[model samples]
Target: MEALKEVYSRSFFEQFVKVVKREYPPFDKNRFFELIYDQAWPDRELKMRIRHVADVLTQTLPPTYEEALGILMRIAPGCRGFEYLFLADFVELNGLSYYENSIKALEMFTVCASAEFAVRPFILKDPDRMMAQMLAWSTHQNEHLRRLASEGCRPRLPWGVSLQMFKADPGPILPILDNLKQDSSEYVRKSVANNLNDISKDHPELVLDISKRWYGHHPHTDWIVRHACRSLLKQGNPDALGLFGLGNAEGIDVRQLVTSTPQLKVGEDLIFSFHIQNLSNDARKLRIEYEIGFVKKNGSLSSKRFKLSEKMYPPGTSSVSKKHSFKPITTRVYYAGQHKLSVIINGREAALVPFDLMDGNP
Candidate 1:
């Protein structure tokens, strides 16, 4: 499979130059291209290339912020892919002197490529001013700008700088999330959930309070709350589980638990079978999951959970058969050692079953 980062190829740079020239006829496209594409251009990574493009824009465009922003605004309507993120990058690179212009540029540029990452520095430099702008943007007519309002202020945005200030005190972000919680756009709502999820990492009680206040208020808000509380649910937080109708699995029994092999080589599947009997008089809502205690090189177990099912179990028994592949992938490496598997129902764990992983030859 081709890498998504490879989208910032020479051809993308050429197209960006073409758009710049078409939007602003006076732009020196040749000089801009030359500055960005030197002898070692191919060797540069994606972000480095993006920074190079921003640098080239700084040199080729007018020195004044407004003039450069005007040129960027004109070219933004034609931008299609991740390459256009350079527009917001340029604003971050050069627009600190004129904060208002930079914010406006971000509002426009986000429609093409996300300005979420670009807005972080501004928020860090002057949180009060930038947060006020984000609050106003939460009501913007454009969904992208509205999404940026919440996403930009995330305490732990991936691939972007962490907002430590928010991590310490997330009170300020509540207003922005409140304004966007009922947003009509799923795009904006998902961003709000993600922003709240980020907050939940540091301030779980605050998120739970918000979830208590907001869950079931509206269908859209309910969905947002559920997604926002996903981490808490995985961690077996009682309130979060209850919010989703996943209560304690009363009178539940795990029986006939069996593994296909006690020992298997890496890159093979571990097939397991089990039966869950609901011995209760009333029906129970069960959240079934499994945890694999993978043995690490340092001889410690790292537990990884996978959701198996979330359904109602009547007064009877149901069988579950699962196959987990230990194929070598980029994200995780399997070490040959004794590992453990266990079942969890509605936040309760069962007795662990041990297994052994071996190298292929052994």
Candidate 2:
């Protein structure tokens, strides 16, 4: 697979230069290239490279911010996808002082590539005005702009800077979420759910209130509410579980929980099996999940949960077997040490088992 950073290759810049030169005749292609591919260029990661390109544009484009934004607005529609988000980042890097022009540029740029990250700084700069603009954007005719309305203001947006004020008091964000709850675009709706999910981490009751009110109103809204409460459900919050008809695990039993081996090596699979029986006289809903307590470098454990199944279990025994690979992935670093695996049924732990993880080829 091509590294994500490769999107800004020489070909991309060659094409981008052509696009900008058409909008602004004075665009200095040679200088832009010279400055962007500097000594530190290769060492820069994805976001650092994006900012480097933005900085280079500041030097190569028209002298003033407005002139540069004018060029950007004309060239933006031609630029599409997450790779072109440097256009929006350029706005965040240089357009804050331009205020109205910056907002206008963000509105235009988002049509092609999202201004989600760009808009957050503006929200922090002037909460009332920027949030009002965001509210207006919630009902935008374009799906990307509508999605930006929810995505930009997310309290804990991944990769984007955290909106600490919103995390503390997400009241300003609620109106925008409400407006986009029934959005026609699934992309926009997902952002609304994610925004609510971010808020749920800090203010669970507020999200629960919104969930209870919106869950049954519309199918789209229901989907948003269910997804928004995902974190709460994983944490075994009774209210969140109850909203989905997943109640106490009083009658659900884990007959046996066993791993293929107590000690396993990296790049190997930890096969496990268990039996579940329902003691309840009637059929009951169960949300089954597995928890892994991974050892950290400091010898502390960080618990991560993976959902296994959720279905109606009758008053009988059902067998389940699963294999968890210890394969290394970019998102998580695996440490070899004592680990714990637990079976969770209906938000309650039914069994806990220990295992040992060894280094490669052990």
Candidate 3:
């Protein structure tokens, strides 16, 4: 697979230069190319390349911030995609001092490509003013702008700078979320859910309160509440589980829990099977999950939970079988050692089983 940074290749820049030249005839395409392909270009990563492009634009575009932004706006609609995020990055890198113009530019550019990453610096510079603007954007006619209202203020927006102030006290963000809780677009609603999810990491109680109030009000709101409380649910928060009627495992049983292999190897699958019974007479909601105590570098265990099933179980037994692969992936390293797996029903651990992992054959 090609590195994402390769999207800013010479081919992309050729098209980019043509559009910019069409809008602003004086655009220094020669100088732009020269600077863009400088000594440090090849080594720069995706974000670094974006910032580099934004920096190059600073030199090739008009000297004044507003003038450069105007040219960008004219060419923005012609440019689109994740690759074109640099359009917004230009405003973030150069237009911080020009608040009114930068804010307007971000709004316009977001229509072509999201300004989610661009708007955070303004939020940091003037929380009160930027948040007021975000509140106004919450009701914007453009769904992109409405989505930006929630996405831009995310405390821990991935690949974007974290907003410490909002993470510390997300009071201002709540009003924006409230206004957008029932937005018409799923794109906008997903951002609202993500914003709430980010908030939940720091202020679980606050999110729980909001989830409780919004759960049954509207279908959209219900979806948002459930998604927003995912982290809390994963942690077995009683309040979070109760919202979905997934209560404690009072009348559940785990039987015949065993693994296919006495010992396993990396890049192999660990096949396991078990039986679950609802011992009670009445139907009960059961969230069946598995926990893996992965062996760490220092011989300690890092526990991770994965959901298997979540539904109502009647007074009977059901056989279950599943397999988990230990494929080599960039994100996690598999350590060769003794490991354990367990069944968790409704947030309660039911059965314990141990397995050994050996290094895969080279």
List the candidates' TM-scores in order. 0.91, 0.97, 0.94
Worst 10-residue stretch by lDDT in candidate 2? 21-30
Query: RMSD in angstroms, all models?
Result: 2.4, 1.2, 1.8
- Across residues 95-140, which tens digit of lDDT does each residue of candidate 3 receive? 8899988888899888887899999999999989999999999999
lDDT of each: 0.87, 0.91, 0.91
Counted clashes in each candidate structure: 0, 0, 0
The residue-level lDDT of candidate 2 at 148 comes to 90
lDDT digits (tens) for residues 150-256 of candidate 2: 99999999989988999889999988998999998999989999999999999999999999999898999999999999999999999999999998999789988
In candidate 1, which residue ranges exceed 4 Å CA deviation?
24-48, 359-362
TM-score preference between candidates 1 and 2, better one: 2
Alpha-carbon deviation at 226 in model 2, angstroms: 0.5
For residue 346, model 1's alpha carbon misses the true position, in angstroms, by 1.1
| N/CA/C clash count, model 3 | 0
lDDT of 2: 0.91
